[model samples]
Target: MVKRSRRFVAFFLAALALVLALAFVAADRWSRITARDNAELAAQSVARANQGLLVSELQKFRLLPLVLAEFPDVAEVLADANPEATAHLNAQLELLAGRTDAAVIYLIGRDGVTRAASNWRLRTSFVGQNYGFRPYFRGAMRDGASELFALGTVSGRPGLYLARRIDQNGRALGTIVVKVEFDRLEKAWGVDGGIGLVTDPHGVVLVTSRPAWRFKTTEPLSRRALEDAVRTLQFGPSPPARAPLSLSGSEASVGAGRRQEPYVAGTLPAPIDDGRLTALVPLQPFLEDARRVALLWGLAILLVAGAIVAVLLRQWDRQRMLLQSRAALSLEVERQTAELRDTNARLLVESQEREEATNKYVAAREDLARANRLGTLGQITAGVAHEINQPVAAIRTFAENSTKLITRSRPEDAQLNLGRIIALTERIASITSELRSFTRRKTPVPVQATLGSIVDGALLLLGAKASSQIEIAVSRADREHVLVGDRVRLEQVLINLLRNALDAVGKRPGAIQLTASAQGDRMTIRIVDRGPGIDPAIRERLFTPFETAKSGGLGLGLAIARDIAREFDGDLWLDPMEGPGAAFIVSLRIAR
Candidate 1:
């Protein structure tokens, strides 16, 4: 039963675990999908916002170059006809460049020669330098306006060159150039965990949030593009690194860093421009977010599952307990019902037994009364003969002795002898009277009697048959030991025991010892015989009717004796010991 219960519990737990695991898995997948979408949106927003800043910054200075192209110091520097106007124009350009945050303001002739510049006074000035091969100069001569990023030939610093053609008389005279550097913009864009970088049409990073990434190409450069970059020296001679990210899909890109950290990128195109602005944000936040969501939701789902399982298990257990309790109650009721039936059967059996015992008692009483009368008459007859023989022999001896004294002329002696004869007759009469009374079947009448007196009377009756052949002696304390019982019945029991003792000692050297003692409410009378002990084989039924050891015995002696002893509310049993001879012990209630 216990094993089955445990198996049930184990199965329940396994089922609960399976349910909880499924719940956790489902919740984790859902959370992961939601988190991924959120990450994509977040990355795209960063990319677009950074892109707006880049475009706005570029627009802020876009008009400056176009406006500067219309300025005319009479075009005197380009013609070389007014040195005063050129110097004054140089000073004014310097002041304008400072105010507008441009790197340099310069003018070039139609031959692409640096005619006047804001840094004309400096050692590395663009003044008097020829930039006819530069793309911005070449493009400005052909087109009305041009914009290009290149390295300055005189200063060797990288900047975006915006140029416009100065046209007069249906021909281009010189170009007005404006150099834009975004040192402050780079600092603002690259700080505070947000980044933005512009990639050229050829996929090179022109400016970036991180300085280390500037001038890096987004894709592998071919031999031609490398050669072009080397020849121009626009970004120095260093081999540019590939951009950290590659386009992944519509809105996201896969990015790798120096240590190969995972990143997600969002790309945007510059409006009315030729570059791409991209924002690279680390994917760690998205991953962490997804992981946290998975973990928390998984735990919550499992907790709810466990709680529900607990409630179900508890409810199941309660039902099981109720069922078991009903079974136990049923068993208890059955057991009690069985006991009640058994008790009723026992009472019926006892009633039948009681009725049978009553019938047996009535029949036994009538038989006992008749048996006692017959037994009294028989023992009385034997006792009378035994008593009459002893006194008759003594009378004869005294008669002969008196006759001898009379013959010797002793008259006084003769008178004394006659008196003894009369006394002997009186004694004989007393013996006869006692026998008559003893032989009558009277109701058992208890009187105070000594143990010794009872034993002596029984011995005298047995005296007719070689009474001196076996010895009999009583202890002094037992001779006067008092008790209450019918003297005749006790005497009868004693006489039977002594007869058996004498017959056992026939023709052998033996002795009889009688003992008396008291225990609790009873007095014990033990008759011990030192003759051939009672036969062992018949000892078990020694007191049963007609069971005896003697050759002609009726075996009624012990049976009758034991019954008479118990008639006084006492019992008898043979001594259960290693006896030298037979020993019978009887107990009688002691008188108060």
Candidate 2:
């Protein structure tokens, strides 16, 4: 029966470990999925922001030709259609080219002759070219403004051409064409680790961030991805109920429309002045980050599992050794019982020792319970202190200002101070409300707040009782540094530690320095005191509940402060610096 019980216990422990291992794996997978989804959402947001910038840029291009056509000299030259007038027009065109990113600005006469041009000295090839039949010029004559069209070449550059017909007394005279470099447009679209494409409604690529990829056959993977996205988009704006279909034989998770997930593709309707822009961001890069997290989680779980197995095996071996000792002791006990039958008096002393051992065990259990209770109280006190500090500080500041005004005999200043004092009193009342709620053991709500404010609040709560001889200095290295945390809880930790430091210093000219600074992904706050430093004998037991160095004092302050730090996924530890002062450090993870 004993062997069977041991076997059952061993199997049970193994089964428990296996269950825990599986849970760890599931948790890691869920985390990866969540991370991937968030990355995709970020990518989509970036794409939308880029689209807005591109549309604004396109509108600027559309306006450039209209702006240039209004120049009086150009208008006058086009109306006269004379050689000397054309020379004045040419000079204005040169100024336009030098001032803007426009490649060339020129006038195309009704008779299909390039009468005047800018950079014509550089490119005489375009001189007198018959461009009267060009769609951009014809469109400007027909429509009020020129429609954007792909210009094949004046210099072998495919660009958007904007033209405006020169009219005098309601008679069409000629056309003014402005060629905007498409290469610049392409550069603007290419951002955020992805390519953007502007295509006409007919699917012909008008411009692309990647010119080399233009008109190239889509890869099988990309072709299927594009087709699936188009189909998903066809279904309209509703999000897919489940994961959209992935590209065939690929691990990539594809979605049809814009999504908050790790991968997104969508056709954004460009402004009416420009063609539609299709934005596609590959999720594979973002998934790599998720995969890395998963790998780390797996490694951590494996380490924990291995440790559990080692502990269980050691326990089993120890139990076996204990059982062997018990068997040998039983045999010896039988022999002793026979001998004790002849000397029963000696057995009483042995029984007394057994009773003493049992008493020791009971005392140990009582001590453990006392420690637990003290730890719980310490946490409660720290939280209370943190919550009460904010308003107390505000009230103190206002009261001090009011006192100064009244003493100065300035009636107007005193009146203004009285209003501020009232405002501060109301603030104190609100803080009291929060304190009442916090002490009721409510869950903490995290918010973005400055470290400076938290420190001030803590100092305020301590008030004058914090020891007049103790000079407390709170300094922030960078004022703009912000952290996301439960403000009340953080203040509680700070105030408790500060109060302890003040007590440590006692009625002497001791300095307590509270310093806060940020170091990438973490914020470190150091509380240093120049009091009688921690006694070497009790330094290790400083955080142990109910173990105080000071007479008649409960040693729960440091314990409670540590608990609050851990609650925020941070840590509090004693600094190992050797000096005449004691320092305690609290480190918290900063929000990225």
Candidate 3:
């Protein structure tokens, strides 16, 4: 049972393992897909937020230069090249710069000279300094307003220059420029986490959260882009994006400062300044989450599979126990059968001795009683002797046939006849053994047997004694049905029921019906006699051992038969009814 159950479990586990593995594989694939998409979204969200904040910051100072250009004093310094007018404008410019949070505020003349400056109070002042090389300066002379990001020549601070043309009646006079710095904005992005960068049209990192990452290019710059950098001096004295790192796809490991870290990066176009925003997210946390889910699912599958296998093994053990019990029953039945044969042999010898010791005839009154009591016993004994006679007679005829074949000098024909004679002797022995076993005290041990076979064996043992009165008929379906009981014991039970039925009819031409049937898991054999039914007085103690209605009966036959039936997981009873004769029914378990 264990071995067979293990094989079943192994196959079960193998099938379950395959299904679970497929499920895990599907989950893993889904997790990877979801993680990748979520990473991109996370990076995009971070980029959009930082970019919006940076643009709003820069926009706050956009109108400053244009508004300052229309101021009267800012034009006074340029209209008259007077030192007193410049000094007055410089004082106003300094106050305005502090109010507007400008890094440096200055007015540049049409000659590309800084006529007035806010930082004139410091030693690195822009008064009387030439700014013709600056794009904002040249652009403002023709265009009304222009913003350019670059490093200041004097302050050396990197900032955006918002320059506006100073005009009177459509005639350009000088330009007003406001320089804006983003030290605060960059500092804020750093604290919020994730690397932030705003690149120019040339792809140069202009504003960044990291100091080391500033002015670095995400992709390679061409010679023209390099020239634009030189003219604008957007990176000041710093190198243009540190030889543009060799970029892979959105996800890759690259050096940030000194050490390389794995990252999943994404780009979003900035709506404010036409720059690109990029963010990188790590993959370690996502991987850990998928691993945890897989572990949990795997554990659950094992638990369920283990439970099913345990139940299957338990059922297997029960079946194994039933098989072992059946084997033991067969052995026990054989042992009892052998013992019955021995006991019957001893009893027969003792009976013969007692008969001889007693007188051949009792006195007149005792003779009538003895004849009445011993009649049934005499009939039963005659039946057994009659059963043995047929086989003995066949043996005698075959022996005569053998002798005649030998007289004809036909050795082969003689040998064939001799074999039949031997077979007949064995049949006689078998009949006697069966008769002895039938009369013995039965100790039933249940085993699987066909009801029909037991019924046929019982009728055969009765010989011609009950053949004329008894009509035995079993349904074809019932004949094939199995009963769980010792074969010999069941045969004995049927024989007892039949004999009682035959005796009930006696010499009368009455019908005794024997029929086999099945209901659910039970097999039944019914014997009905059409003779005077059992008397009410006798019926009360019908199955009591050693109490009999028949004068010669010890009454142990019906009691022993009932007991044997019960031992074989069956029952024998006289079913009550308003009928002509008694109906005895035997019921037993069907083999599974």
Candidate 4:
């Protein structure tokens, strides 16, 4: 018996050892793969952020050349080469360059000779520089616009050149150029741990976080390409050297000998065509941290499992010894009874928890419905206040005037003023009544509501809060169009749509058109505005709750309006148009 017990112990120990060895290998492999993936994700995020900065910078500078190209001074300098016009433009360009944080803004004649520059006052001014050989100048002359990233011949600094052609009477005048440098951007990238690089189509590094990596070739260049690049001086006097980095899929190895380091690389295409932005993150740290954590967890689990097994084995031995005793049978009965009690207790607790969860869910749903109505009312609160304010002010004015007239024994005029006050008070009451009816969360009672009355009610709520510059024209035939819908709810839908149209055309020279047309048994009310159209970014989610373009909007008005329309078996939608501005169409059942 002793020999058998010893053999069993040895077998269990060997099994535990083998299991631990297998777990270690599996954990290590999994952790390494997970670590690399995490590194790649991080690298990708960095790459996108850096690329956004590059694109933003490029876009900002590109606008400068276009603006300058339209300047009369630029055309004057290009057409007549007037020294006074050139000097005046030079000062103007210098001031503009400073305000816009651009490196330089210059005008190139049709011959590709620089006539005026923002840096004309500087020692290395490009005022007399002949850039006829530069691709930006030639391309602008040929295609009317161009952009290139290259080393500036005079300053030897690298920047992007955006050029736009200046034309007068269909004659090519010259090209206006804006140079934007990324020194500050590069420095900001370098402050972070990872390396950032921007490469052109030919894999030539145009900008890099590491200055040494700039003007370097990410890949080998052909003999003809090298000669062309050198002759054009695109990268400056010295030929671009090969960077000490190699890429293989998502992995990268940088440096040489003992200093070599591995990285997880991620890349994104730049906004400019054929350009790419890359980020390289060190892989060693991630790998080490992940593996160490995984190993520790594995060891902790192995220790816990071993302790459990030992406890079980000791219990077995104790039971074996106890089985020889007289009280062993009683003890086993007690253990089974205790287990049964515990199971019954757990079942009772679970049943109670389920009941509580169901009750909470029902309450949450009720709260959400109430909140939705309140949110809709909140969006129109400002407009309602504006609608009531004018009448309140007029009532106050008429009340004061009546008191003065009564004291002067002018009873007739006093009575007239009092009547005016009464009329104003009635108007205020009407506004409040309309608002209160709109907010009531009751089922709609469909009734025949004239289209003209609905349009007038919505306009009353809008008031004169917006500028009088906007013309709201309603077609005369709308009065003949009647709809089968809840009058108050339909008015609310019109109010929402009209309010949006007014806001869209605010301070702009545009008119709001309220047109109604009949198709079979349905009537479609169209609210069209000549304002800037709906933004494409939010077009897909226009009717979604909490999706809004207005800064101070709650984004619930349209959603609530749409819901109200659908309650009467009608629908509201944005109509497509070939012209500028937006059109909202509300279709309802026409009165039979």
lDDT by residue (1-592, candidate 2, tens digit) is 4576568667977787788788777866776676657655764565577678766766776777777667776667666667777777778788877887677888877776777888767745455888775667777878856755453445655566778887777888788887776676577667566656655544445567766544322222245534543443321232112223232221233344665333345456665335566565666666577767777877787798678767765776777789889989999999998897867766687788889988887565435434533443353454445545755676677678778878888778767767876776676675555444334433456656677767655654555345344454545454445666777667777767776787777646547777777788788888888877888998888888777887766776677678768867899998977778789999987765
- Residue pairs that clash (backbone atoms under 3 angstroms), model 1: none
Per-candidate clash tally: 0, 5, 2, 0
Q: Candidate 2: deviation at residue 129, Å?
A: 1.9
Whose lDDT is higher: candidate 2's or candidate 3's? 3
Span of 10 residues, lowest total lDDT, candidate 3: 364-373
Among the numbered candidates, top TM-score falls to 4
Give model 1's TM-score versus the native structure. Answer: 0.50
Off by over 4 Å in 2: 1-36, 188-192, 215-267, 272-274, 321-592
Task: Mark the regions of model 3 whose C-alpha exceeds 4 Å error after superposition.
Answer: 15-28, 243-253, 256-259, 271-273, 293-592
- Give the C-alpha miss distance for residue 309 in model 1, angstroms: 2.8
Candidate 1's C-alpha lDDT? Answer: 0.74
Lowest-lDDT window of 10 residues in candidate 1?
A: 249-258
What pairs collide in candidate 4? none
TM-score of each: 0.50, 0.44, 0.49, 0.54
State the lDDT of candidate 4 residue by residue for 1-592, as single tens digits: 5456657767888888898889888998988898999999989988888988888888888788778877889888888978898889999999999999999988888887899999998999998899999988889999999888899999989988888999999999889998888899898776768898888888888888888888898899888878978988989988889998887778998897789899999998976536888889999888998998997899798889789678756765765686686487688779988998999899999999989998787555334434554554565577668767877898888889989999999999989988888888898898777667665555547666787778766666555554243354546665667778777778878767877887788756447777777789887778889889999999999999889999988787788788778867799999999789999989888776
Better of 2 and 4 by TM-score: 4
Kindly list the per-residue Cα lDDT of model 1 for residues 387-433, writing each as its tens digit. Answer: 68777888888889888988999889878878888887887886666
Q: lDDT for every model?
A: 0.74, 0.65, 0.75, 0.82
Error of 4 at 554 (Å): 74
